[model samples]
Target: MTEQRFREFKMPDVGEGLTEAEILKWYVKPGDTVTDGQVVCEVETAKAAVELPIPYDGVVHELRFPEGTTVDVGQVIISVDVAPGSGPVEAAAAPAPAPAAEPASEAAEPEGRQPVLVGYGVAQSSTKRRARKGAEVPVQEPAPAGTYYASPAAAIQGELNGHAPVAAPAAPVAPAGGARPLAKPPVRKLAKDLGVDLATVTPSGPDGIITREDVHAAVAAVSAPVAAPAPVSRETTPVAQAPVQATPVAGARETRIPVKGVRKATAAAMVGSAFTAPHVTEFVTVDVTRTMKLVEDLKSDKDMQGLRVNPLLLIAKALLVAIKRNPDVNASWDDAAQEIVLKHYVNLGIAAATPRGLIVPNIKDAHDKTLPQLAASLGELVSTAREGKTTPAAMQGGTVTITNVGVFGVDTGTPILNPGESAILAVGAIKPTPWVHKGKVKPRQVMTLALSFDHRLVDGELGSKVLADVAAILEQPKRLITWA
Candidate 1:
């Protein structure tokens, strides 16, 4: 019988500077057969909860940690055995040279073939995380000339001995005492930022110095800014400066939040895409009155009742249908392999603006879904993003994307193409506007469709044709018969 080795899989730091993660639930247990791309577990980091997909396909041999336990990164989570006749199977043993055993207590060898932990694992020194740039560190300083400082250990010793650590009495004051000089510029700036005044902050640095950190602590104590002194009776006052009412400095009052998460990811992707890929955007305004009439007709249809049918949904469907005609639009450029991957399935991404940040969660294989299914998927995607529950997996593997800025009451704007995708469609507001319908001026529900594609992959002619076809389907819903 061929010996089977189990591969141990460890939990990786997915993102968001995760230190420890709580295992929400496990999708598989011992003896369960699992495939690659299957959701193995859901874990909650500090920022949000994410469903983790497995990268290897095997039968579950054992699980190391149970659900709800907070596991550190690089900890073994699961073990899967290599099937018989799977080839390249090795018996479990220590790969490194082991010293002559002296019967030291050590962890038992795992029962079955466990995955050899590689990559970021094994090296304890490499796992040490440095603090981020803006993180604050504590400061330690000596006591003043007349005051005495006691170490925490000494204080504890005194407490045990029935005496508490106390400051020594100050020396007698010298004659002709003068006010101490004020804090320095950096210390004053720190105080300003912390909302502490130089006069109020205690000097803790050497020689009765007021360090920047002391001012910072004083400012932090007063978390919220103190309200301005109530204005004196303006009716009775007629002074030259009017008492110089204290007003917060304009720019100084603004709060600065660091860019992170989706915002940070979006910025990095956009810059890489904008500069690397030569973007060519083409726009076309279409009279969508017919589409509006169809929407109104469907609103009363019994089959579509209780569904949140909207113009954006129709536009999304139209774009999907057009993608079938021009495959170049739904493709990716693999610079490394010098290949253009034409995707048959559509991972349709919808750009949604939520409270946290802008997120584009794609509907996997959207082209294969029915109208109702697509609508429900769209609804769920929007709701998940709104609740900040959209997983990172749902936001990836998108072949093409659509940004519906019309929801924000904006007419039209150029949208950045999502990285890895060749093209992105921007759906504008469908509003009543004067149109040239059959050579006559009339108000109609018109909309502008802007298609931004990578010029290298999709040419002007192909892009225009795709956009025109989508518009045609919207202009006359009956045309979808041929397109679909």
Candidate 2:
């Protein structure tokens, strides 16, 4: 008889202390051959979406949960047959009907499950998780962190002691002729957000998954203005009803989107920051024609070639220079310790608006990077955020942040401070305005900048200097070279 063995891959705690994650997608199906280090699924945690790779090379034996199902950490999500040619596909796919029960001790903590926090691998009796339900496949423990396994994955977050994980909400199914519509959670959420009836959207994707494009097409079709009534040569039947954009659905007057994932985390953080910190906002307007010119010039510079060079790049550099000049403003208030924590390094955060909501992913050691290096980092950060791939780690430990409302064509407004950070700068749209330059009123590219900081950590004098320094640098591009 051929030897048969299976390797089970459990959901690892992708982020520090995250308790669960939703299986956003699956790349492989039963009977599909997979190689080690190949991504088999993508999952969305409370933080961000990440791709999970298989560490074991084998034929996919089964998927324990369907897509859009929220799975708790340490649950076996996929099984793979390590030994090939062991049996027919039918036998491998089906679980044994009358399998023998395992000994009591064998149902202990899984080998592949990882610790959720640093210095947390020690097994305590209080945190003991009950044995999971359904089929169990034994597998080797995962390699330690700092390997490929720990990169970019987010996890479900909650208290782990004596609490059963929350049941995943039912995935919304489009009405497809009394059969369940095939669509992922994100697609369903999109359809609902757009107020487009999924039943009206045609499915063009494989396996009938209603894609985002389909939902958008449906919205476009309904939103297109009714064509003006054309002159008719012959008499046509009088229209029974007036042309309307779209017939109202039976009962969609109100939408209560469940607050979870990134949106949930953001709301909590905002409320905490708002209540805990004392915010003071200061604003200044500056002529940034020279700085804007420098942006265009840098785009042609060989050293900066192939890098993203924009006004934001120069503004970021200006902020770094200002921080360097006013080091005290880079400090955070340690409320519990009753001390101001001054940071020597700057992890400059750029506030980005995503479909999931606002997120601030920082550049580590921004104070150390050269202009070109900073530009490259900014490019990567913006691109990663737009793709919704910003990891939890990328969003942590920010010292200061910048929110550019100018991208939306809005003038500057008082921005809120990111939690644990000293300040946030808001950048407004750059426009051509009449300004006094060298004793003459000329049309100059001007912009408004607003800086909001924690009053306890940064007094008026310190905050003003930081804001003034940035304005000075923007007014004179040479200050970056002189002051930096």
Candidate 3:
């Protein structure tokens, strides 16, 4: 019987100085056999969650970590036991030709330095292609006289052939020189799906990389402007080409969606928040007539023209002012570390309903901004959220949140707490209703405010006081100056 060996798979630093990652999910188990290129786990980096594809085929000997554990890059997460006389150990040794059939050379190596995964081991400065099998003639495409293949594969092949890959002889270059315009990965995918040639289309991405908009523009450019189809007489009528249709692959009936961008980030965040934090919720409703009128006045003011003045803006401003007054709401409860984090500066999160899902991107240092500055920041946040371009920075370190369910015409809802923040304020719709105003029964614009907080940090009195203060500010905008 041949001897068997185990290989430890350490997580690679998948670019950026990402120190640690949260294991969002695990796709493989201790008993499951996995092949190269199969997804073994999905991990959440600081910016996004990516599915980690396996780099070797082997039986799972052990799982070093479980889901939800924070793992440092380059730490061993799993071990795989390779079958005796398997391709794995040989291919791993193949890169070091001296080690092949030389037990003496392997015995001299250090204990922890042996290569693991075959074909791809510890990266090397120099590379050589594996010799191909069977009888075959060398195939080469003529380079454009002075140009050569700069790809690593071709260069390595050239080195193995005992000659450096040389540039082709020069010729007069045409405008395009048979070179296709560059496009982004997404744009290239779009062009392939739309049957458009990127080389013939104009580019709009930075430095002439094709954008999705560019392809749409190209499609528009190629289409002839229709004049009403001239009356088709029987003599001149011709047979029409059948419209091409995409066929669904057998056994594939579901829509496939890319999970890279916001969707992935949101999922990771929600999961982290739900699982990590202990949540407690509370609610309150207030008549916000004065704040509603203040919005109208701000809209009509000459100083605030050409600006989007909305009630949510005032709610955000009020929330910031209230946070300054009650510092406890602008905090995070860190249970693991046995500490409470209190932030002096407010990272006010606005939970906006985007086409993708709920994204709570925040305004940094919101408490420092003046009314107009806050309004401008709120405007940008809303517009960016709607366009689905909210950056990761805008989504972190939220000291408090305001979810304007009012926009959806909702009266009240117990919103889930944002991941790190201690409090989330749900602002409901303002409608004209009967109310007591100036000692008289009259119609007034009224709205409900629901404040949800982590009870572990915020007590009933503290939460109620914070809720009442916000209601007082909205009920009388003049009261904000005094209460804040």
Among all candidates shown, the one with the greatest TM-score: 2
TM-score of each: 0.56, 0.69, 0.53
lDDT string for model 2 (1-484, tens) is 2224667788988888999886655666666788999888878777776778899888887666544456779867887878777655432221111111332233353444333222112221222222223323232222221111111111111112111222333334536554435665445545444444466678999987787678778767867322221322211111111111122233457323345567777889899999999999999999999998888788899999998788888899999999999999998888888999999999999887665666789999999999989989998987677556688899888999998877656778998899999999999988899999999999999999999999988999999999999999999999999998
**Candidate 3 structure quality by residue, lDDT tens digits, 228-337:** 21221221011111111122233555423334334566778778876766666666667777787788888888878777777777777777777777888778887789
The lDDT of model 3 is 0.59
lDDT score for residue 171 of model 2: 39
Q: For every model in order, what is the number of clashing pairs?
A: 9, 2, 5
By summed lDDT, the worst window of 10 consecutive residues in model 3 runs over 235-244
lDDT of each: 0.61, 0.69, 0.59
- The true-structure Cα RMSD of candidate 2 reads 13.4
Residue 220, candidate 1: Cα error in Å is 21
User: At residue 354, what lDDT does model 3 achieve?
Assistant: 43
Off by over 4 Å in 1: 1-72, 75-130, 134-136, 139-251
> On a 0 to 100 scale, what is the lDDT of residue 348 in model 2?
96
lDDT of 1 at 223: 70
